[model samples]
Structure formats: structure tokens, C-alpha cells
Target: MTTFSITSDNLFMVSLLFLIGLLMPTLQIAGGQSIGVCYGDHGNDLPPAQEVIDLYKSQNIGRMRLYYENPGALQALRGSNIEVLLDVTNDKLQELNDPSAANSWVQNNIINYWPDVRFRYIAVGNEVIPGGSAQYVLPAMQNIQSAIVSAGLQDQIKVSTSVSTVVLGNPYPPSQGSFSGDALTYLQPIVQFLVSNGAPLLANVYPYFSYVGNTNSISLQYALFTSPSIVVMDGQFQYQNLFDAIMDALYSALEMVGAPNVEIVVSESGWPSAGGTVETIDNAQTYNANLIRHVAQGTPRRSGRAIETYVFAMFNENQKDPGIEQNFGLFYPNKQPVYTINFPQ
Candidate 1:
């Protein structure tokens, strides 16, 4: 009997495969339903920063997004082990456009409490492009990212910006998604920067808006991801839920811009429990619960590749507009959950 010998190259390939298989589960857990909460403090009755941190600890939420650097809140996060996504306001974008100013801002806001606070990302601005604030976005992001690089903190912290669905040009059918108007001019370079930096394309994707805006076209079940009750075909792919459709459309848009490999992060998505039409406690509960389970399994296109997500808000903001804007929170100002939903332990 003759036996064939295994070559060194073949052995190396086998080892690489084994290593990949070994790390897959850990990556899944890290990127899975590691749900985050957006800590928007636009309310007068909300508790103190320390109390809010304690509340998050009790609920096992390991990530949170703060719209700006709040010294008090940053102090509260000391040793909290919560991964934080800190933001720079749009008004401050012009200032941050300067490299020196960006460095100083990072040193003051981020470097001061870094390792202890677990700062993970610096979101340069929220929904700045495609609006009057559009001109400042890219320069601000470049300066911030460069500042982080100069500080030798690029590996620890990512720099990204979030955009709403308003940037898309009729994103239905998914495959035909592309940025139009003035948005295209700004979006291309931004996506390129994200891809080069190995950062995600942060988006605030809300199916609720689609449903409310086109009530005749979108159904409640489809928007809520309750069932594949109405399937919309895009080429050979079948879209059963609005969230996946919107996400794939974004992916398609990235492909159009030559950045198809860039990952996406659903920075904000939630249903208001009151104020808007069809907005109720039951629907909110169903939406969020189903969202958690759906994300845990990943989307069809990105199977086994977890798409990290953060729920829209931590508390109902009384200071926001009286109607729908104030009601997106999973909790009330008193730190009480609006409805029961599962969170990763």
C-alpha cells in the first residue's frame, strides 16, 4: 500500500481553517445580540448620570451611545465596562475640521477617561450630510480620524458618522438603491474613508418611517418583521422584512460607490410606544423583541456575520417634540422599562 505525504503548505492551510473555525463562535457572541442603548438626555426628569449607569448595569446593557461628551456622564462610566460611542455635534463640526482642534477635543473629551470608560467609537456627527450642514461632514471626520491616529489610538477607537434614510433615493427593490442629488457628491468620499479605515457605515434605519410615510405600500407585519406575509422580490433575493431590505439597499448603495465590503451598523432603530398613528405599547414590544431575535440570527445576505445594533433610546425624551419624537424610548424618565424585551446577558 502506498500513502501520500502531506506538504507544509497543505498543513498551513489546514491550520488556518481550524483557527477560523475556532474563532467563529467567539466572534458570533461578540457581534451577536450585544444590543446597545442610545442614552439621549433631552429630558428634564431623567436621573443623574451615576444612577443611569447603575440602571444600565442592572439591565446587562454593555454598550451606549452618548450624543456628546458629558463630563459628568463620562465620570459615571468609570470602570463600568460599557463600550461607549461618543459623538461630536454638527455645530462643532466646523471647529473639529481643524486638525489641532480635533486633537484638543479628543484629548479633553476622550483621552481623559479612556481605558476606564471603554470608549470604542467617535461618531463625528449625526445626519449632517445632505442637509445645510453637509459641507462640514467629511473634513470634520478626516480631522477626527487623523487626530485619533496621531494619538496612537486608531486601533482602539473607530471614527464614523450616522445618516438617516433620507440619503437614499427610493431604496425600494433593494438592488436599485443609489444615492442621488447632492448626497452622492458627499457620500462617495465618506464611504471610501470608512472602507479604508475598516469602519462600519453607521445608519439610523427605521422601518416605522417607511410604514407611516407610505401606509398604502408597507404593511404592519412586514414593517414589524413579524412574518414574511408579503414578500418583495429583488432579482432572486426575497425580502420578508423592511429592516433587511433597507440594509441590503444600503449595501447596494455602497456597492455602487465601490465600497461593497464596508460593514453596516444600525446605530438607531425603534418604535414609538405612543403619539404616532399605529404606535402602541404592544407594537413597540413586538417590534423590539422581534428585532433582537432577528439580529441574533443575522440577515440572509450577511449570514453568520453579526450586524451590531443599538436600540434608538434609553428614555422617553420629554424635551423632544411633543408627539412621536418623545416616545421612542424603551424606558420612561423614571428608568422604568416601557415594555418587557429580552437583552443579551
Candidate 2:
């Protein structure tokens, strides 16, 4: 029977070692650009949670962002060393308005399966800007973040909300990005909060949407990121494609409000393969293929930063809206690539 002495020095050493252990994984994530796929299951017909995870591994995806806190998905991804970013639904936004509910939300959903599940980011809600239901999103965001801090998880798990490109008033020129006049009212305070708290501004950008909506106006090659185009320039800064255009839209908006250094991450961006896109299956293949390669081989744009991107989904969700965008999956439901995509090669 050996009873070790408990002293301040011993406790301090233990705490330091624990922190270092925690930082080891963070270092790995920051080692290079990391990519993720959106794991939206608005469909009951998709594979079981665990099987879906296996499918993710089969495709060599290392990171994913889920739309809910369903335990089954968390349970499956727990020991996989994959990063899980969870979202609290817009309807549940009001829950965060109450401290107790917010605390419980983080405890039950976030902290409950922490280190084991590799939950890195808790997306407060999805696309808080455009949705009518997300009107209560600003205050709700504050409350959820308060919960994150209360649970002592803020340092480890980040809190953020995704915004659609609709938030941008002028997204094309990149240098001229601005939040829409209507959305600016709600977004100002939200952006201020995020800036104060060090959360990434997530933009759900889709060139397919831009092109499909304005087919006669824009070129397919530009949307695919493969064609050479004139950079929309403000003096010397040149943005090439929709990706950079959308990002700079937000960047310019943020800079207008004086929070220039706040990090902006592409929470969602992708090209659909299976159906309903004018961009040809070959274009989808080539576009998505090159997009992954470019993202993997990330480099600084004129602003001196490496771009962050997440291709839409791992599998084609049949239960999703029958529209073409709903079919925006890189792989078929059978768990195989829709086309050849060079990942980091």
C-alpha cells in the first residue's frame, strides 16, 4: 500500500501534464489544413450511425460536422480519432436563452462525450442568417456560448454559427463584400459577439447554387475552380473564383466592422455529382476533384492566408429533398466515390 503525498507542487505538475496531453491533438489538427464533410441526416433511410461512420472511413474522410446531437453518431465516432463538430438546431436556439437549459445542452450534448468522442466544435445552429426560424439566433448564440464557458469547455471546444452567402450584399468582387441590408441588423451583434469570443465565421458557400441560379450569367469553368479568370480586384487584391469571391464577401464585411483578423472558415462548400446540375458529370468530377486537391495543397491568397473548405457530404442522401442540391454528394449511397478524387495527392 503506497499512499502518495498530495501537495500543491504535485497538483501543479499533474495539471501541466494534462494540458500538454490535450494540446498534442490540437497540434495535430493545426499541423496542416484539415477538411470535413457535412453529415446531414434529414433522412431516415441512410445507414445506421455506426455503419455511416464506417462508410466515412472507407472513403478516407478524417473529419465531419453533424447537424444534431444524436448519441448514436457520437457513440460510433467516439474512438475513431475523427473530429466531430455538432450543431444545435434552430428550433432549440431559444433553449440557450435560459442559462439552465443552455448548461444542460452543453452537458448532455457536448461535455458528456468529450475527449472520447473528439468533439471539437459545437456549431450553435446552422445558417442563422437566411432562415426565418433562426430570427432568435443572436441571443441564443450568446447563451449557448455562456453555457460552453460555464461547463468549462470553451477552451477546448469552439462555438460558432454558419451563415449562408446570402449574408453578403456584394459577393462577386471579393473586395466589395458586405452583409445584406436586411440581415445586417441581426448579424452586426452576432458578428460582434463572435469577434469578441474568438469563433470562426462559418460561411456555407456553393458555386453550384450561384451558377444554377444565374446560369446564363457565370461560366461553369469559374465555378469549378479550374478555369483561369480575372481576379476581381480592389487595387491589387485579386479573387479568382466563387470560393474566393464568397469568402472575401464576408472578409470585406468583417473588415468594414473593424474585426479584420477574426478567422473565417468555410464551414460548407461542395459540388453535387449524381443529378440535376448543368455542370456535366465530368465537370462535377473534375471540379470536385481539383477542389479537393487545391484545398489539400492550401496556400496563402493575396491576403496571406490558407483557405479552409469542406466538401458537402460523404454519401448521396436519397431521403433529402428531391431537388438537385439535395443530391450534392461526392459519393453514392453505396459508399463509393462518385468519381475519382485525388485526396492530398
Candidate 3:
């Protein structure tokens, strides 16, 4: 083999090539897919709306989830090219049950921002199933779908509700996952609504809470995506991480409900950085970084398809009840990262 002599110009090219080679695995892992981050504004010291949007752009975050329609954040998002998952708070579910009210709500929040704000999904309510607000979920979804169709935006924005994993009565073994009687009464219609409208069911899947609730049974390595080998084997599928196991369970639940064709979007998943057991900076970084890399590979039940996932909270909210509720943020309220983690570009 012939080699050229080293010069200043050739040396720079060589270094650049080496750096690219090192980054190739990460780039391939992402495969041009980017995960979303939930942007909660429950803090008193968080950055301004424009600055927060700029920070998202700086990190190449492609999607965002807003818990409600905060005008400042909505205004900053205009023309930002960041896809949004906007939510109508649980309290508003009854109001939206009226079609006219739903239309007005859409007009005020979504219609004005359409084609500019890039809203991809509109979650009608969050974790309302198995609760008092459960009654209004289906009606609100129907009215919102009607309004979207009336506005000719149904093709652009999908409507769904976010449900907590508590809805699942039996979620272990990945195959026995099914909704409890109470949750099924509410979820069956909701799942049908999602399937008919071709919208994915949004589920807030959190392994941190699961592990915290049953620390003796759930290993930290498995919860943090560091398990050396498969921890749970169900039929033909093998699960090494808690996230995939939970997702496959969800898929099984949907299939039992006769909605196997419907997709599931992970509305929120995260580990805390402090204020609780096993909640450390290193664990948070490891969890979030591995999440960004793992979601593109999908779950065992739905291999090769990228799972649409959103990590919870852009910043830790000091206003939340003191403890883990305030600690799920990947970044601090001061616009600094709580731990070093890479997002897919």
C-alpha cells in the first residue's frame, strides 16, 4: 500500500474522517428518526419561551409535547418546524363534549396555528381513565374529530388521549396484558375511536415508578436499560429492558381489545435525577441516552418500526410537589442539562 506524506491540509482531513467514523454508530442508530420531549411549564425559574425554543433547536430536538396551550410557547413555536403534541387539559374534557365548544376550542388553539405550529397529535386528556373525568373522553374525542374534519385538518392532526399504565389490569408476562373491568369500560370505546380515526393511542409508560413501587422485584439494571442479558422471556419475544416489555404488553392489550392494527405512541417515559431511591444523575443520563438510541429499533412485537416516544419534561419543575414529581426533567430550569445525554439528530 502507498501512503501520502502528512501535511497540514491532509492532516485536517484525516482527523475529520476519524471523528466521523467514531460518530457513525450513533448516527446509524438514530437512522434519521428523532424522539420528542415533553415541555412542561410548572416551574417559576424556567427560561423564556423564545429561549426555550432556541435551546430545543440548538439540540436538534424534532418534536415537542405541551401539556396545555400556553400562548407564549405556542407563539414561539410558530414556523419553528418542531412537531407538537398539544393537549386539552382534563378539566376541559366535559366542555369539549359539546361539539360547538369543541369547534371553538379548536379555533382558538389549533386553527390559528395550523400549517405553522406543525401540530401532529392533539391529546384530548391525560390519565383520566379509571377516574371521574373518564366519562367525557370519548365524547370529547368525537367532537374534536368532528371539528377537525369540519376544518379540513383531520388529515393533518390526529386526536387521542394519554392514559397511564395503571389502566392495564395484568401487564406481566407481556402476553397476559389486559385492561381491568373499570378501565376497559372506558378504554374500549377510546381504543375504537383511535383505530377508526387511524390515530395512535398515547400511553405514559414509566418504569421508574414501577421499579420504585416494587424495588425488590425489579432490578435497577433492567429499569435503566443496562441489563447484560434478557431478563424476561415471553413466547418468541425476548425483553432486556423494561420499556420494550411494557410496550409489548400494551400491544397485547390492544390486540385483546380487537384493535391490533392501532399504533401506540409513548407519550412520556423518564427517570429522575434526584430526590428518590435509585434516582441519580448517572442513572438519568443512562436511561435517557439509551432511550433515544433504543426507540428507533422498535419493540419485539413490532420490529423494524420506529416507536414515537417523548421523554417527560424539558426542565425540572420546582413548583411540583417536592420530591420525584419535580425531578423527571432532563434539563434544569436554568436551561442547563441536568445530565449529559445525546438526542438523535
Candidate 4:
């Protein structure tokens, strides 16, 4: 089943994730609406947005995560059943704080093209807190919040900011977690607004980075959620798979901050097809296939919470910014499975 609508550049840009938190939602396991896909588009020579929409229908994918409100793409999915979570870049931080600017942005990019696209979430910035030298801090978040309210998008589109793992002071133990002191100055306010607005906090996690960083300590079985149930815990929480372990860590951090009910959403998570010797195709397939199944089955972790996840990508992007390994698409630019992800039956 090759989807011919995709183009060469389609595999390049995938809205990436690096940080996470907050809680709001219509979260559920496998019925009504169940899957989320990061549709990062850092490429140029790809199929028209409408063609890609056709491919999604053929595959039964209902949710799409876009890096920005590319009106052309939004227009393509209008009236379709898909839900989109559009993002904003760091460069727009200043403009985002101004209600007028945000209103204009929406009037031009969103209001003019909503309901058709059904924008459900608007991620203010991608990993802004730890954007490394481009840390947008508090203002960007406030700007986005202002825009959401001014545009009267609070009911239709929740506002959020995605963060990366680097923002954490510690993440391994799954319990001893804390935002870097520097990030707290920004996160404190962000979470405050999130809770008030009924928005979810997001994190884009990758066990791949842990495995690649400490191959000697992190086992492949652990990363693939195949590790035996010996168990790891912090206080009363028990963790088995890397996903749960990470979630527990985030949960614990929230508890520490007295925001226990704050909803945490795995905004982006996945395995890559091509990378260093350790990041092979087989490992990639195992990781993603299991993840899709885990989330699909609404399988419970040791914590007893049904895990929710968004697979990293739908297509490989050729023009994504240069990085350790950016070509992590589940499907190639030709629209063939990178391997069979086996999205749940």
C-alpha cells in the first residue's frame, strides 16, 4: 500500500519535542479519537497538503501535529475528520505576547481557516525553555496565552509549549525530577496559566537518546518495553517500561509543585529508522510498533495509568535542520512504511 501523494521534501520537517507538563483534555484510550502524529515539515519538495490528507485517510490516522499553521495545509484538511495541533517558532515570541499581534496572527492564519481544520491545540513554541541560546522563557508563553484568549480560541484550541529532556535537572530515576532553576522562572508561570485555561502540558520524549547516550547502562529490552517486570519506583509509583518510567518522573515533578492533577500529554514520541550503529532499523521498528500497541491497547503501566503517546512522524523529511539523526519517519518520502509500524489493529 504505497501512498503516492507524498513528495521528496515531505520527510524533512517534523514538529520536534523536547519538554513537557499541565493538564486538560478529552483523553481516552482507543475509541472515538485515539492517535496523534507529529507532522513535522522541514522539507520543500513534498506533495501538496491535500495529497497528504488523502494518505492519512487511507491509513486511518485522525490526529496531526504540525510545526506551524501553514494555511495551505490547514486548508487541505478542512472539513476532514482530522484534528491538528499547530505550533509557533521562537522568532515569533515577541509578537506572540501582544494581544493585537496574536489576534492578527489568528485572523490571518487561524480564524480565517478554522473549523475547516478544527485546530484543537496551539503549541506556543517548540522547546522554548531549553532552546539553547534562544530560550524564550516567560514572555513567549504569556504571548501565546494572550493570543488564545483574544482570539476566543480557548474553547476550540488549547494553548501549550513543548519542552525537551534537556530542560530537566534530572530524569533517569523517574522520581527525582526537577526543572532546571533557570527554567522554573519560566515554567512556574507557564504551568500557572495552563491550569487556569484547562490546557495540557506536553513533552516530546525519546528513549533513543538515553540508549545512545549511555548504551552501557540502558538495555535495549528496557527501551523497547520488553524488559522483565523487576520494577523501579519512586515512593509509591512503580515503573516497568521506559515510557511509564518517564511519565512517572514527570508526574513526580508535578506533585512536588502541587499540580498533581495537571494533565501531562506525550506530545511527541518515536524511534528513528536511520542513525548510528545502535540506532538501527530493527530497533526502530520494535520501539515504535510496541509503542503504538501500548497506547492503542490503553495498556496500563505499573503506575496504573493508561499510557498515551504520539508517534514521532508519518513521513521522512529531507530538509529538516541538520542534527544527530533527523530522518526518523515511520514512512519514507515515497509513502511506504519505513518498516511496518503495525499501528494497532
Candidate 5:
């Protein structure tokens, strides 16, 4: 048998090899799962960040999306295998619009954590344009990206904003979809930024919202990702569920604007477990489980190119508004799953 002794020059190589060994298994598992979860901490009763991280690991959850740069949450995520998307909340958009402020925020929230946290993106502002924070969204995004560049972390972290499905106009035909109303002006520039930066368009697509808005027309089965009685026809495509329909519409809208190469990341999408006329444990499970399986297979129009998706929530948020707002969690406040769902290992 041959034995090797460690030397000063080989120490860094050994450490790197050990770190890679530790992370490779986890990285492979996460890569296979593809699906991610949104960690919304609005529930007073929700467990601490450490416990939440534990739950994620136990479930083999590889990706997580945070609503803000919460220190405690980021700390808990440190050295974990899960990849994260950190946010700059809508209210903070104005503050981060300035290059100096954005740099400060990056140093304080992201760079400060570094490789330990595995932060992949800085979601500049959540649903800002439609919510009237349009003026600040693009500026904040640019500033933050500039900050990342300044910090020498641009290659490791990307920047983009999460937008609502409401930004689209007449999204039915998919191919005919385009940004409408006041959104067009803001979207044109935003998409340009995304294209220039080679970042994805972060979209929060909710078939639930579409169904809620038109209950009489939108079938519950379609929203739930179950067997729909009627299949929606859009050009050469046949949509069995509403998720793909909404996604294709966004794709079409991007193509129309000459930003066809810009990819989309479904930043948030899930079914509520309660607080709605149709919301139920079974329905939530069905929608989410089917989503996991569906996203594994890319949209028909964009065959073989699976769109990365993150489910809306990890736990039921009690602090959210009454009705359907607080019930989109996959787990309870205790960190237990609301229902069983598989993440392919």
C-alpha cells in the first residue's frame, strides 16, 4: 500500500477536494429535483430559520427563494447545499435605486455571506411595476447588478426582478400574448436589461389567480393540474393545464418584443392549501406534485428546455391578508409537510 503525506503546497488542494466531495452529492440531488420552494416568513408561529433549513434538507429540497435578505434566514442557509434567490423588497426599491445604496445592500446582505450561503440571484423587487413601484424597479436592478460587479461577485450572482402574471394582456393565444396597459413601457426596458445581463425574466405565474378571476370559465381541474374536461387550443399547441398556457404566453410576449432569447424562471407558483372556495389539501398536493412532474418535462413549445420553477411557499403565513393570501404553503408552521410530495432523487 502507498501512503501520501500532506505538504504546505497541497493543503489548499486537499481542502478544495474535500469541500467538493461534501457538496457534490447535494448538488446532484438538487440538480435532479429541479423544483424549488419560496420561503415566506410571515407566520408568527413559523419555526426558526435553522429548523426550516433542516426541513428542507430532510426533504431533499435543493433550491429556495427568499422574499427578502433576512439575516437570520441567510445565516441558517450558510454552508447548506440549497441554492437561494434573495430579494430586495418592493419598499426597499427606492433605497437601493442609488448605486451607493445598492452597493451597501450587497455588502451587507449578500457579499457578507459569500460562498457559505450559495446565493444565486438578487431578485431586485417583487411585483413592483404592477404595484406602482415601476419607476424604481429597473434602477434598483441596475444598481444592484452594478454593486455585484463592484464586489467582484457578478459571475456568481445574477440580478432580476420578479413580476406578476397580471402584466400580460390577452394571454390566451400564447403566440398573441404581449405586455399591455402601463406595463409595456416598463417591461420593454426591463426585458432589455435582462437580455443585456443574460439573466432570466423572473415571473410569478399563478393559474390559481386566473381561475379565481374567472371561476365560471376556468375549470378547477385545469388549475389543479388534473384531467381537464376541455383542452385550451393555442395555435399548434394543446394545453391540458393552465400553467403551461401562462408560461407560453409570457414566452410569446417576450418573442414579440424581440427578447425571445431571454429565458424565464418561475420565481413563485403554488396552490393554496386553504382560504379559498376551491383550496384544499388534496388540491394543493395535486397541483404541486403535478407541477414537479410537469416542470421535469419542459413546456411543449420549448421542448427539452425545462423552465426552473419555485413553489410559492414553504409554510402557511398567518400574517398575510385574509382569504387566499395566507394559505399557499406546502408545510405547516411546525415545519411538517401539509401533504406528501416527491422530489425526484
Candidate 6:
């Protein structure tokens, strides 16, 4: 009694949904099951570590990005069940190049808290590439990996570094993305190492900076994911938001480096609520809320898989340099939400 024909669009939709189903199971293990928030304790007036953990539990936030091995924070995180993306601060990168130092660092910070603290990834350095500290990144990562293997935790935790979008030479049009010559020298081997170890590249993607840099060309609606229609068409892929376009660009860059399979984890992304251009409570809430919902849909280039992301950050840091840097937090230093944001469980 019923007859139907599957069009190309229908087939594509079916394929996408099937791929999504396959990816759903891996989300939790990969830290993509729910949105994560970066917990930066740079302000003197911030709450105690235990109170912060309690806040996270109350909000249903499933993951956290810790900037370093803060003894107090690590102690508070025990048995909390919140997956953590721990960072190896830039200052410690060169020191970690020594295998013994790396092992000791891991033994003290990670091994000491094992089973109680769920560590997902150990980012060797944050946005240190394309700078003077670039040379030490790969070595530190190698040493850390060796340490992790020695501790019998190699399979449980991944080692990588957080990089900025500045590493991209040509990022526009998404499909034509490629790493800059300067950055490739530092990133090539790192990419290979990540591919071999099955670790994702941590990237700090900030569409806010891109939009503000060139407001005439980049629209706010596109950056905020409020666009009603497709904004950019790159070959067969259609991009409706800047976040997906930027992510696809990174994906394309990885492909150019002969490591197309290397996955990307958004280590930091957020909008400021004040102290900058177009920074307002409404805009910040819109951007973050939309980002949490959109990451689950994945990017066009890497369709049907959730993109693990960490919003930067939990509280506004008064200690940070004045301006937008201090205003990216989702909550105030007093522990009150700067604006209401819902995190899906």
C-alpha cells in the first residue's frame, strides 16, 4: 500500500545517521559524552577546590580541563568521576624532556591519583607551537608517553599538546586548509607520533578572535551559530557556522600532513561576557549554549561524530591580564554563574 524511493539526499542522511550511531558508544571513553568546562584557579577570591567540584557535580558537567597538576585540585577530584584533560604547563615542557623527570612527574601527579581520578588526556603544552617553546613540545610528549607506558597506564591515557589555530597558513574555504611552513617543521613529527599512538590533536579554537579580527568579512551570526542558512559552500560540504568551518579547516590541515585519521579535540573555546567588543551576557550565553549543542553534531569534514570540547573557563580570573582574557569564564569569581547555561548530561 505504500511506495517510496530513496533520493541522494535521503541516502546521505541515512549514512550520516548510521555513522552517528557507531560513534555514540565511543563518546564517553573519548570525553565527548558531555560538555566540559575549563577550571582555572587564577583568582584569589575563587572558591575552594572541594566547593568547585561540588559546583561541577551540581551542574551535571561531566568533564574538566585542569591547567596543571594543582595538588589541591587533584586531591579534590578524587572519586569525583569527572573526566579530566590535564595540561603540562609550558614552563615544564623543557624539564619533561628528560625521561626520569617525566616519570617522576607522572608518578607524583598521575600515578598517585590513579583509579580515583579519571584522566582522559595529558596535553604536553598549551599553544606553545609556532613560538620559541615549539622545539621542546615533541620531546616532552615522547618522554611523557614513555613514562605513561612504564607506569602501565599508556592505554588508559593519551598524551598530546594543545595548539592554536594560528598554526594554519591557509584556513579559509575550509577544504583548502594546510599548516604553515614554519609550523609544519614542528608539527609533522608530532602529528606522526599522535597517529601512531591514536591520540587526538588538542586545538584551542576561538571564533571570537577571528570574527573580531575582520568583522566586515566574518558575520557575527556565523560565529555565534545563529545563522539561518548555509554561509559557506566548500565543494560538496556545506557549512552553516564558523565553528564547523574552523574545525573542518583543521581536519583538512591534518589530511595535508598525511595523517588524515588523526582526530581533533577542541581544548579551549568560549566567548567573553564583558570587557571586549560585542561582549555581552546575551551573546556569551548564546555562543556557549549553541556550542555545547553543536559539538555533538560534529563538523562537515568529520561528520556524524561528537567533537570533544572544553569551554574556557569556569570562573573569571581577576589575576589574568586585563581585558578579554579575564572575562571568558562562564561564572564569576564569586561562584555565581555569569549567565545561565545548560549542560546536557
Which candidate number maximizes lDDT? 6
Across 280-328, the per-residue lDDT of candidate 2 in tens digits comes to 4565665555555555433223244565666677667778767665566
lDDT of 1 by residue, 1-345 (tens): 001111112111101011122212112222323688899999999999999999888877889989888999999999999999888988899888788998899899988897898888888889876888887889989998888898889999999998887787757557777776678888889988998899988888888887777655566777777643435766777777778888877888888889989988888888899996678776777677667667766665666666678888899999998988899898898877887554546
- The segments of candidate 5 whose C-alpha lies over 4 angstroms from its true place after superposition are 1-32, 228-230
- Top candidate when judged by TM-score against the true structure: 3
lDDT tens string, model 4, 1-345? 000011122112222221111011111223315567787676675667888888777766788888876777888888877888788766787666676777677677777876677887777777767545334545666666676677677788888787776656666466676676776767777787778888878778787765566545555566666665534544565555566666656665666666767777777887776756646566666676667656544322223444445678877788875543466787677777667643322
lDDT of 4 at 234: 48
lDDT digits (tens) for residues 1-345 of candidate 5: 011111122111101011122212111222346788999998889998999999888888889999887889889999887899898888898887788998899899988888788888889888776556788889989999988888888888889988887788657566677887778888899999989988999998888777677655566666666643335665678777778878888899999889989999999888888886678776677677677767767776787788799998899999998867788888889777777665655
Cα lDDT, all candidates: 0.78, 0.66, 0.82, 0.65, 0.78, 0.83
When sorted by TM-score, best at the front, the candidate numbers are 3, 6, 1, 5, 2, 4
lDDT string for model 3 (65-125, tens) is 9999899999999999999999999999999989999999999999988888999999999
RMSD of each: 12.9, 15.2, 11.8, 9.9, 14.8, 9.4
Candidate 1 colliding pairs: none
**By the TM-score metric, which is better: model 1 or model 6?**
6
Q: Work out the TM-score per prediction.
A: 0.89, 0.84, 0.90, 0.83, 0.88, 0.90
Candidate 4 global TM-score: 0.83
Worst 10-residue lDDT window for candidate 1 reads 10-19
Residue 291 deviation, candidate 5, in Å?
0.6
The sequence of per-residue lDDT tens digits that candidate 6 reaches over residues 1-345 is 011111112111101011122122112222236579999988988999999999998877989999999999999999999999999999999999898999999999999999799999999999887899999999999999999999888899999999988888888778988888998999999999999999999999888887777665666777787766777877999987788988898899999999999989999999998987688766787778778878888899888888889998999999988887789898887778888775646
Better of 4 and 5 by lDDT: 5
